[model samples]
Every structure is written in C-alpha cells, then in structure tokens.
Target: MSAAPKHDVFQAVADPTRRQLLSLLAESDELTVSALSAPFAMSRTAVSKHLRVLSEAGLVRERKAGRETRYRLEAEPLQELRRWLDYYERFWTNRLSVLRQLVESDDADEDVLEPRGPRAVD
Candidate 1:
C-alpha cells in the first residue's frame, strides 16, 4: 500500500485554520481537541483534521488521554520556517540599505550642483 503523503511545515501552516490552531496551542501547555475547536465556527472533526496536518508536519505532538487525545505545540519544526524567512529578511534589508544610500548620495550631488542664489544672467 502506498504511504500517506508527508506534509511539510509550509504546507501545514498554509491553512488559516491550522495557523490559528498553532497560535492557540502555543499559548497553552496542551489542550484537548474540543478545547481547540471551541474558538472556531467549524465542527470538532474539522479541527481534528487541522491538528492532523500539524501532527504530520511535526509541528504538534499528541498524547492519548483515555478516550480524549490531547495535543501540544511542537515548535522545533517551525525553526526551519523561521530560518528561511530570516535569510530573506536580511536580503531585503541589505538591498534597501544600498538603495537608501544611493538615493541620499544623489540628493547630495543635486544640492552641490544647484545654484545657492538667483542665476547671474549676462
């Protein structure tokens, strides 16, 4: 039988609902599926599905509590996403700095070239 498709951190967080779930879980030590489902208009099953995606991505861990399953945020997987974003943040910051310098240099040159007073026409 073919294995279930694996999910990555990006794919896991692509859904707004899943992102919300992550945010909620991050604020607490752990919570039951029902507690996680409380804030959303969707049913418990839908919330469970989102949790499943997160679990597959390694962003969440689940523990069996009798008939209830408790889930907690596993933030290590998110480090990968953070690192990727940080690299681009640095890239854009450097580019913006260079652009700012160029603009300021151009302004300085314009100041030097402009006459300080009215032109003395012959």
Candidate 2:
C-alpha cells in the first residue's frame, strides 16, 4: 500500500497562525522559532508547532544553526496552492463574465422598463 500522506498544503495553511508564520518566513530568508514567535503572544514552543505543520507540508525547510534551528520558506509547495486558486479564479472569472453579459444585454433594459405589477400613478 502507498504510505499515508504526512501532510497537505491546504491543511497546513488552514490555520491563521500557520499562515502568519509563513508570511513571517517570507519576509526573511530564515528565522529561528524565537524570532518567528516574537511578533505574537505565543511561546516559542507554540510557534514551533505551527512551524512543524508548515515543514511537513514542504512549505518551509529547517536547519540546525549552532544551538538554534533556523527555518526558511520553501515556497515550492505554495505554488501548488496557487495552482488550486488559479483554477477557481478562472471559474469565478467565467461566472462573472456571464453575469456581466446578462446585465449588459439589451434584454435587461427591456425588463427594467416592464413593471412587475400595477404601479400607483406617480
């Protein structure tokens, strides 16, 4: 049997904290858990947990630096997320295009002129 998936990118970014962690890592080439958690009220361990999710999703890579572990954004996994979004982006774009056409059609103007029912004399 195929090995169970360790993590999925969609699941990893579902958490707000993890999203913020990814944003933080994006701002810098690499950061330690302490530095990454400094902007938040959570402890380093809490931040580490979030980082672990991102790491498993392949969104970030970590390396041991002296006594500290440094984490950097992997980014490639995010491209998968982007690809998924692009599919919906096209879906919405097509939907909106159809709606726009319907609204702009001459038939819409005729509908506006027709009264739904008897209107009180103005």
Candidate 3:
C-alpha cells in the first residue's frame, strides 16, 4: 500500500478534474468511480486517483458495496474554504464602499482617481 497523501482541501481542489469530481459527487449522495470517469476522457484509474486525493483531504467519503466503491462528498471541510472567502468578501465590500464614497463625494481627488492609459512619447 502507498503512503497516505498529505493534502489539504485547497490543494486537493486545485486540479480542475478533482473539482469536477466534487461537483459530480455533490449532485448525488454517492457515485462509483466509473460514473465519475464518464464525464472526462481519462481512465477510471485516473478518476480513482483524484478520489483518493479528495478522501485524503477529508473532502470525500468512500464506502464499498459488493465489487464497487462509492464516493460521496463531505462538505464539512468546505467550511474552512467558506470562512476564508467570507473574510475576503467582507474586505472587498469595505474597499468598494470606500470607493463608492469617494466617487460620490465632492472632496474626492479626480486626478488621483482618474484611470490613465498608456500614451506615446511626444
């Protein structure tokens, strides 16, 4: 057996393929590796590898039934990502509010706020 992967939710979801798999898993309670592989051109083994990464990151849960293994999304780990994004959302909201105030206020500096494009030398 290979060593367990040390991956965080952010790292696991970095790959587009893994992100797709998460979406697929999220839509349903559980799906086999084959079902997840159907959307992509890669082999089932490739999908399995992605699933393993998600499992390692605690983003997914797996259970075996007969000869097949089913994978499901574990959305709890996503809370961390949500919290991180929430922080930035508030940050940008504050920044945009200040910008709005600047735009509406008469005391604003037009020269500093004006957008400049590249100009040719005279």
Superior by lDDT: candidate 2 or candidate 3: 3
Ranking by TM-score: 3, 2, 1
- Residue 3 CA error for candidate 2 (Å)? 6.1
> For each candidate, how many residue pairs have backbone atoms clashing (under 3 Å)?
0, 0, 0
lDDT of 3 by residue, 1-122 (tens): 87755899889989999999999998999999988999999999888999989999999999999999999999999998899999999999999999899899898888868779986789
lDDT of 2 by residue, 1-122 (tens): 96644788999999999999899998999999889989999988889988888888888899999999999999988889999999999999999998788778876777664659987988
lDDT of 1 at 20: 95
Q: Whose TM-score is greatest here?
A: 3
- C-alpha local distance difference test of each model: 0.92, 0.89, 0.92
The alpha-carbon lDDT assigned to residue 57 of candidate 3 equals: 91
- Tens-digit lDDT track for model 1 on 35-57? 99999999999899899999999
TM-score, model 2 to reference: 0.84
TM-score of each: 0.82, 0.84, 0.88
